[model samples]
Target: MLSNPRTVEKTALDEFISQYKAYIPKPALVKSEPVGGTLSEQIKRSVTVLDFVGQFVELSPAGRGLCPFHDDHRQSFSVNAEKNYWHCFAGCGGGSIIDFWMKWQDVDFGQAVKELARTLLKDRR
Candidate 1:
């Protein structure tokens, strides 16, 4: 939550963006290795779905957690470390880190991939 009431907007996206930027510095975005299949492939290979999502949501040993996208009662959200993908059984959809990022940030595929490169490349790989 924003402490200053004069702030423009206080949406979840704003908070998420703030936390994400703090976690990954701006300078680190260009420090990634350029030796992957493609942009999206490189981003996905940089970090696993389990590790990435685990940063924001606490996951059990089975890679299960309360879905952050919805009012999840059960631990409908699960990550496949081996496969490097996540799925929310509550109909929220499922895919790799880039997919989840796109949904979380409410951005398009291109923008999601760009942001993922910034976050995953610096220290994860």
Candidate 2:
């Protein structure tokens, strides 16, 4: 019997993953590529953080822009299309599109999802 609960859980999870590793794609792609498996997924896949951010911020030729969340001037913000995420080098915080929406709108997670669905899915319906 393993005394450490975390170790026991890890072992079980590792065994399960090894058994079904082929069933999963991008094992650690949770942050950028959310597995919502629904409308949110559509929203995420239909566009990228760079394009979304570009709608409001003026990005440079290389997709770098000033941070809007703070008083930045040296283009501390950058959007990575390959990773499908945005980040602020000035330590303002960073994450996926949903996180950006939440921060931009000054709203909570639920509000962010609702607004994103409304805006992004407006054309689908």
- In candidate 1, where is summed lDDT lowest over 10 consecutive residues? 25-34
Clashing pairs in 1: none
lDDT of 1 by residue, 1-125 (tens): 45665764758658778778877846645566556567788887776788889998889999999999999989999998888899999999999888898889999999998888776676745
Q: How far is 59's C-alpha from truth in model 1 (Å)?
A: 0.5
Estimate the TM-score of every prediction.
0.68, 0.67
Candidate 2: give the clashing pairs: none
| Clashes per model (N, Cα, C within 3 A) | 0, 0
Query: In candidate 2, residue 1 scores what lDDT?
Result: 33
> lDDT of candidate 2?
0.83
- Scanning candidate 2 in windows of ten residues, the lowest lDDT window is 27-36
